[model samples]
Target: MKLSIERAALLRAVARAQSVVERRNTIPILANVLIEAEGDEIKFRATDLDIEVVDNAPAKVERAGSSTVNAVTFHEIVRKLPDGALVSLTDDGASGRLNVEAGRSSFALATLPRQDFPVMATSEYDSTFTAPAPVLRRLFDKSKFAISTEETRYYLNGVYMHVADAEGRQVLRCVATDGHRLARIDAELPEGAEGMPGVIVPRKAVGELRKLLEDDEMKIEVSVSETKIRFATPEITLTSKVIDGTFPDYSRVIPQGNSRKLEVDASDFARAVDRVATVSSERSRAVKMQLDEDRLILSVNAPDAGNAEEELVVAYADEKLEIGFNAKYLLEIASQVDRENAVFLFNSSGDPTLMREGDDTSAVYVVMPMRV
Candidate 1:
């Protein structure tokens, strides 16, 4: 195989492919990126058994062939090459090495037969739909932070994506929780996804998929089956196996009748919480909140460390309330509100609390309080 590709195009393709290649791989071929030069484009494919990503870039191909080269090593070499210098890759059938040449730099990298690459098998998707990149971005971005890191409850370690009715209309939804905090975000359902099956997208795949959604106007083609999910754009395709488990029914966890209302500027509340949490110890950073008619006081007290207190003017009309919560949890949930105020609903100090951006029900968060 022989091909010439511009430095920027080559680097972008290799960087996307190598993210799936683990630093320490048990299988030799898994450490390599499968490169194929054909027609007027080159394709770079990488996989880790569970997830696979393929990136396509335009190139000047003199000969049509394929080879597998170390993804990490090739990426490093291409990254160091001078800008605008054309990179040439060549492999002869008899030699076990691939030649990389650009400007005044040259290197011979070991190659594995392209036939050894483990390509994931394709399946018939029960549902396929197209969504704007910004819509999909909000669905995953607002919920992924709450995904659990616990291995035992593997079901909770991903975002549960499905179609559900919201405000008398069908909407696509993403829900994630770690038993302490829960995030639910909703987007308008696409035309062909009415019958889509619910699936749990693993944390790693969610992160990798995010990189593809930077363009707000791009439309992403999403395909899903019982066992697999695929997201594709014009130049890249990402496929992964969905987690095989049942997500707990989260509706029960969302508080229904919590009427105590507190409205505060999201930015102000976040800053106050952060300031008061400084005196908390590393072990169990807890911040106590005291609410009255129109004032809120955030305080933190740690026996080993010092104490801190901060006050903010808020809109609250319910009875006096005192609640304690994990400092990290409050900060995380607060950051979700963009330029709007964060409205919180409470039933009691021990009961789970609900927060949302202004009065919008499309994105809701529930956080369990900690003992002060």
Candidate 2:
């Protein structure tokens, strides 16, 4: 395969492909990226058995052929090249090496047979829909932080995407939880997405999808089947297998009858929690919230370390309540509030608390309380 591509274009394609390649591979070909050059374009494909990404870049093709090379090495070489320089890749098929040349620098990388690369098989999608980039971005970005890292409960390790009824209308929703906290975000359902089956998008796939959603004007084509999910754009395609398990019914986890209400500025609340937690025990990192009338006091006490306390004037009219929570969890949940005020609903000191941005029900968060 022989082709010449601009350094910027080459670097963009190779960097994306290399991210899908696993560093430690049991199979030799799995560590390499498949490069195919044909009329006016070159394609870079990489997979780690579960997730696959293919990136296309415009190139001047000298010959129509295909080759495989170490993805990490190719990316590093292209990244270090001078900007605007044209990069040439050539493989004679006779020699076991691929030649890379850019200006005065030249390097030869060992090549693997293109036939050895395992490509994920195509699936018959049950649902296909188009959605604006910003809409999809908000759905995933707001909920992915709560995805569970525990491997045993594989179902909880991904964001659940499905169509659900919200306020008497069907909406596209994404929900994620790690038992301690949960994030549920809703967006307008696109046309033809009414009957789509719910899919658990794995954590790695969610991270990679973020790159494609950076362009606000770009439109993303999403295809989903019982076992696979694919996100495609004009230049890039990402495909992954859905987690093979059922997500827990999260409705029960979100408290509904919480009577006490507290409205506080999200930024000020997060900062106060951060400062007070500084002197907390490393293992616990717990901060206590004492609410009385319109005053809220945040305090952290540790026997070995000094204690810290901060007070903020909030809007709380209900009876006094004291609750303890992990400082990290509170900071994370509070930061997700986009609006100036974050509303917290409490039932008791031990029950899970519900939080949302003002009165916006579109995005809601639930965090379990801990003992002080």
Candidate 3:
């Protein structure tokens, strides 16, 4: 294939595909990007067995053909070329080499046959829908922090996306948990999603989809089947295999009857927990919170080291209570509360506690307690 493309356009196309190709895939073909030129368009495709991304950009097509080149090396070379320079890609079938030239810098990247590429077979998708970029963004952003790292429960390693009822209204929801903390978020249901199959998109897909959803107004077309899922924008399409496992029923962990409530400024609480946890050793850093009436004191005590306590005036009027939680967990969950205050509901010191945005019900988080 022979094609000439603007450096900026070339970088944009190859960057997406290269990001999908892992640096250390076991198969050689999986590390290369398939470049095809035809009808004034150049397409960059790359896959790592599970996820494949294709990018199409406008280019000057001198010859109509296809070739594969190392994704990372090509991306690096294209990145180094001066802004707005012209980049040409040329390939010869017999030599198995693709030449990339820009300005005085030129390199020949080894090529593999494009026929080796594994494309996802088309499926009669159970459902297809479109969602505003911000809606999808909020759905993933609020829940991804709680995705499990445990490899055994692979289903919990991704944000669980499905349709559910939230306060008598059909809502698109995303839930994730690691047995310690759980996050559940709801967005207005989009059309054509009544029969959608629940898919546990792997962690990498969540990340890649997030980068593409940065433009708030950009609408995304999502297609889902039992084995694979695809998300597309105007120029890019990403398809990946869903984890073939059952997601544990996450509803039980969401506490319903927790009565004790503590309302504190989210930023202030996160800051207090962060400052107190600084003294404790990494492995056993726990922050003890002593709550009484409207006054709260957060303190961390380590036997060999010193201690720290910070007092914050909050909205609490319950019986005296003392609870301890992992400082890391507290800081992370607290940071997620973007609004001014975070409302935490406790049911005894051992059972899981609940957190919500002030009094809002659309988003809620549950966190397990750790022994002090």
Count of residue pairs whose backbone atoms collide, per candidate: 0, 0, 0
TM-scores for every candidate against the unseen true structure: 0.99, 0.99, 0.97
Pick out the ten consecutive residues of candidate 3 with the lowest summed lDDT: 117-126
Global lDDT of each candidate: 0.95, 0.94, 0.88
Of candidate 2, the 10-residue stretch with the lowest lDDT total is 277-286
- Compose the digit string of candidate 3's lDDT tens values, residues 137-239: 8888888888999998787889888888887888888888999889998888999987888888888999888878988779999999998889999888999
Model 3 residue 146 CA deviation in Å: 0.8
Local accuracy of candidate 1 as per-residue lDDT tens digits, 59-161: 9999999999999999999999999999999998669999999988999999998899999999899999999999999999999999999999999989999
TM-score of 3: 0.97
The model with the greater TM-score, 1 or 3, is 1
In candidate 2 the C-alpha lDDT for residue 155 amounts to 95
Question: Residues 257-370, candidate 2, lDDT per residue (tens digit)?
Answer: 998999999999999898898886683578999999999999999878899899999999999899999988999999898899999999999999999999999999999999
